[model samples]
Target chain A: MKRRDFLKNTAVFVAGASVSVSALDFITPKELFAANPQLKWGFLVDTHKCVGCGFCVKACKTENDIPYEANVTRTWVERYVIKKDGDVVMDCPKGARDGYTTKLLDQNHSGMLLVPEDEIAQAFFVPKLCNHCTTPACVQVCPVGATYQTADGVVLVDRSWCIGCGYCIMGCPYGVRFFHPVEHVADKCTFCYHRISKGGDTACAQACPFDARQIGNLKDPNDPVAQTVLSQRVGVLRDEYGTKPNVYYIGLNKEVR
Target chain B: MKNHVWRPLFVVIAIAIGILLFRAFYVPSDFGSQEQGYTFGYHRLSNEQEWKDYPEKYKGNDYCNECHDDKIEELESAHHGTIPCENCHGAAFDHPDDPEKLTIDRSRELCIRCHAKLTMPSSDRNDIPGIDPAKHNQGEECSECHNPHNPSLEDM
Candidate 1:
């Protein structure tokens, strides 16, 4: 080959290398957090603002189009009323999707509804969901590597990867994960990563009628979700299990404890 | 730290690749796809009917009528007119006959499957997005309190 031709080819190669190297910078971990170095993954659920409307549950169902066969609780709200005698009690009168509504409307089963008398001088509803723990047992005990913690710190399952093993269900301290019957896979909340990371919020967070649920990036100390966690003496469910979960509940009731 | 910088780069790069390789291949499949395990779920054997799928199934709405005929009639009258049955039940090719066969994938996991779709609350307008489980069913799991058959909680 001529020297001139060789020189031209060399020039092109150098230029290409420079451009390719710079391109990688565009792919930095935006979905991931490096400031904390722990890759924190979790959520902030404000109970005081929650109205027990069940919007999060419906939003999750409609948004994800959840199949009917998975008889487990993914995301849901619970109603708790403690009697003046300190007898703490709770009820899911509006149990699951199509649960109480269909029956109460049915004349045959309508009589079964047990509308609880207000427990406190005034009573309120509290919602519950998967904790997505820091040291999650579900992540640890998953026989297959179906579930894992993302760089952003959210614990989630890849349905395609999940083998329908219920180990995670047993491992979950919050009793949130369920073995979906139809998909035959393990499923739970991804902290609404689709919306949260992409500059949006979660279904349950937005669905709260009384401004109960709030989502935020822990990295940004100014984030509202994080602020809610700080403002309220919120608690993680089953902290004793040592999952170090990200899902936080504010104004939790005796029923939850 | 001049020409020797590449030496540190080489060591870090090699270690990163090694960790990636181990995570990608050496890890067990059980965490994601358990080759061994056991699972038992809710199913009605006595009501062993097939999941429905009509030839003219525009939306799974027809199956809703066949199963919960009353709810379908009520849903038609409610504000939930444009909503389709499959909106909640993903691709019901075979729901009734063998609900055990394919999964409808409910629970909280369903929320973030789509890219860039947000479910954040407390933003004032909860519309543009979708329904929230709490308010929709009034603290009950939509399925438990309300039956998809008729799509109403009139007392169910």
Candidate 2:
């Protein structure tokens, strides 16, 4: 190329670089430049500590203002009673609203009585809620970007933007997402986003009378959730799905899916 | 150049430049501030206010701690320190202002939610024991034996 052409090209290149750099400044906001909190919220559920009183379930409904209904739930406790033959009888009658109580079954043709509590090999209450996964399947499957993970690692639903397609409900391996009966949008536990963002615990965790459900910030080294998760044996639900769930269980049983 | 190619190509490039220039002016100056790196239109959703202002049902622990400082201090130092007061008492939406509205859930079922044990895989839960409510204190409220705030009964 001629020297004149080369000079022209160099000037154009320099101008383009300067404009692009300045354009980036406009695109990126000042708040983004501020120091990130680097907080990742997590939950720990101790099954052994859970008594299946269903208070957490009730608390979640109340805290989230979930309308009174049998089908929709942000959280629920499953009572799993494993028989001696390894048959697991899981029940959460009315989401355990009345709590678990022994009910004598009518005698069968063989005149067998209800299986004695002592005879049952094992039983435990596994309280289930949104895992708030690191790589959430619901977020991944969202059709209109309605479901998204915040910078702090809490998965949330943009209800206004959600189409109520129910893709997230089906995509979630933990089955946390549900279509709100009245709102007609896909909804699930947000780890109490409104509360947690203001430095409060999740509704269920805060309402856990026995401290069975605990919410902590993984970013803070002093946070119990961070310390416990690092020091203790924590298990995430459905690890095979590779969702990297933030909700960990302290005494997760093999019987638990 | 082909007879038809030059005219269409020139028009397409002009339109493309026009759109880009228009977009450059249209996008807000603070559009991508909260978001890092380049996204086509990610920041528009970040600017929304609805996500931040959902109707909060639980009034939060701080609200309770404001008026009940003594109870907060006692619970903070007790074995049940981790348990929030609202767990035993229902969410006090208008408490302190309307203290009478706060419902203290002293139901036996409330106590059993965590105190009653079910079997699970063996792991360390710090020996947080559970009792069959029926067997432990039949027909008796949990508060009869153990103080809800100070379960260790040190204060008593």
Q: What does fnat come to for each candidate?
A: 0.00, 0.28
After TM-score superposition, the amount by which residue B55's alpha carbon in candidate 1 deviates from its true location, in angstroms, is 27
The digit string of per-residue lDDT tens for model 1 on A117-227 reads: 443433444567777665567777866555766545566665655677689888777777876756777777766665555455565565443456666666566777677
Question: Which parts of model 1 are misplaced by more than 4 Å?
Answer: A1-41, A68-70, A93-122, B1-156
Best by lDDT: 2
RMSD to truth, every model: 17.9, 8.6
Winning candidate number (TM-score): 2
Checking candidate 2 for backbone clashes, the offending pairs are A28-B33, A29-B32, A29-B33, A123-B119
Ten-residue region with minimum lDDT total, candidate 1 chain B: B45-54
Candidate 2 lDDT over residue span A1-257, tens digit each: 99999999999999999999998787565544343566778888888777666767777888777786746798988777678888776666666655554433223344423556566777677889998887677777766666676666667776656788989899999888888877888888988877777777777777666778989888788988889999999888899998898999987888898
Error of 1 at A148 (Å): 0.4
Error of 2 at B11 (Å): 18
lDDT of 1 at A9: 96
Q: Please state the CAPRI-style docking class of candidate 1.
A: incorrect
iRMS of each prediction: 15.4, 4.8
